[model samples]
Target: MNRSDATLFSGGHKGAEAEFGKLAEKFGINEVNFTFEGHDIERKVGLKILSPDELKKGDVSMDIVSARMGRNFSKVDTIRKVIQSIFHMVNSGYQVFVVGWILPDNTVKGGTGWGVELARLFNRPVFVYEQDRKAWFSWIDNTWVEVTPIISHKTFAGTGTRNLSEDAKNALEALFERSFSES
Candidate 1:
């Protein structure tokens, strides 16, 4: 199979890479890059990336944006830099997979969270913590949705290294496959 042009926009943690690795293997994906973890004030701010379809959906990719920018622009100026990077990816025809880690407490707020909201705002598919199995789910919904009752195995175990509980793995695989497959 030909290598797919894909990038995993992770929250930046240890276990998250496991899942990313699995995704890479499943689809022969290229490029696994992490998002920014610092809150610098000198970065530019705006929508991260713009998809070709975005011209019709009026959506923008915020996959590389800083969530803190919405709250910390008062102190940090890194928003534009983050957003611009995201824009560069989208405009360049690369599909960005926004990933969020599931917290042990059944929450999506920890470990560099961004996927759901970013996907929603950008009108792109998202991979999030599977509420029941600790695996990740693709957000194909029109609006942002968060899963509850987080599973531990999928969230803590990096992808490709362990069993991903059939359902969870399937969901993630389907999203990635469908995104790049030509109809």
Candidate 2:
């Protein structure tokens, strides 16, 4: 696929990043972006952690409310950065993939819910790996629908190599194939 068919893997820091990184590499996708915090901001095997400065450099197209708040940054800065980064990636023509743990409240952890919401809002295809449930879900009909059987969740701690179920891999691969072919 051409560079225009690059993919963006969005998730919070920790195990999700590692999982997404491995999946991107496994699929031979060279361009992927996501958000990271603290010491988890290092470069991964196949993904780039978008920095706050990078977000400021892009055409964010949002009114940053804290622009006049001096250098006293807050969660607003992080929120703006995340939103702008996702917007920039999509605007630059990247297909978005999401992976994260779903809370008991059914919300995604690590701020990944925003990515999923953005994908839905923009009518883009999204493949979500519900880590907590060990299920593969596809964004369809404006909702997440399980596309595969539930599997056992790995009990690994922190960010380490985690394997996605074969069904999840296949579904993601099919999504990528369909996206690249359309591009």
Measured by lDDT, the strongest candidate is 2
Against the true structure, what is each candidate's TM-score? 0.38, 0.52
lDDT over C-alpha atoms for residue 48 of model 2: 55
lDDT of each candidate versus the true structure: 0.38, 0.47
Per-residue lDDT of candidate 2, residues 69-178 (tens digit): 21222466555675565554444433445556554544445445545555555675555666557665666774568874221111101121134455545544554455
Name the candidate that leads on TM-score.
2
Error of 1 at 108 (Å): 3.4
Model 2 scores what on Cα lDDT? Answer: 0.47
Give lDDT tens digits, candidate 1, residues 16-93: 344555565565554333234352222122112333343224223343333422322212334343333333333332
Off by over 4 Å in 2: 1-13, 34-40, 44-74, 92-94, 102-107, 148-183
